[model samples]
Target: MITSEKIKIYAHYYGDSDMWARRAKSSEKAILSNDWYLIGSLIQEIELVNKGLASEKFTLNLKKHLIESCDNQETIRQLESLLAMNK
Candidate 1:
């Protein structure tokens, strides 16, 4: 749904449902396999791909959602620690 009103699911390539589905599955697989680097790269792509105001806001909220999704305190702390250390 690439339009002026609706923010695209993904900003790269084709922003369609199928691509979004693949991204979700791939991210899930990466998580299941402890492929942190791959998932990190994927997330980084979100930030990189979004350039518009709406897209930027969506990506920001997406990042917030990801952080909020972590229920474990230690995991959250580790994520925060890693983010803090990021150059």
Candidate 2:
């Protein structure tokens, strides 16, 4: 089970984006089933569709969650390393 703290953090990362939050919040159960790949896909969709649009703070918070919830060390490292290339 995903911790409540993580969920809260994710929700904060989502902020006031109702559509994105709704989609992600609805899929919360499926996301915790060790299906990190699907979660990654969902994240990518959110990033692409909402890219260059979210506030800097929200984007950074979202990126933090992505790094924290990534399936493995490599994925976490990869995402964190990309912070420097934020567009």
- Find the candidate with the highest TM-score and give its number: 2
| Candidate 1 residue-wise lDDT, 1-87, digit = tens | 012111112333133335455665554433333333433443454445443435667677756655554444454343333332233
Model 1: residues with Cα > 4 Å off, grouped in runs: 1-32, 38-56, 67-69
Looking at model 1, which ten-residue stretch has the lowest summed lDDT?
Answer: 1-10
Judged by whole-model lDDT over C-alpha atoms, candidate 1 comes out at 0.40
What lDDT score goes with residue 45 in model 1?
40
Please name the candidate that would achieve the greatest lDDT relative to the true structure.
2
The deviation in Å at residue 56 for candidate 2 is 0.7
Q: What does each candidate score in C-alpha RMSD?
A: 12.9, 11.0
Runs in model 2 lying further than 4 Å from the true structure? 1-50, 71-73, 76-87
lDDT of 1 at 82: 37
Report lDDT (Cα) of residue 27, candidate 1.
47
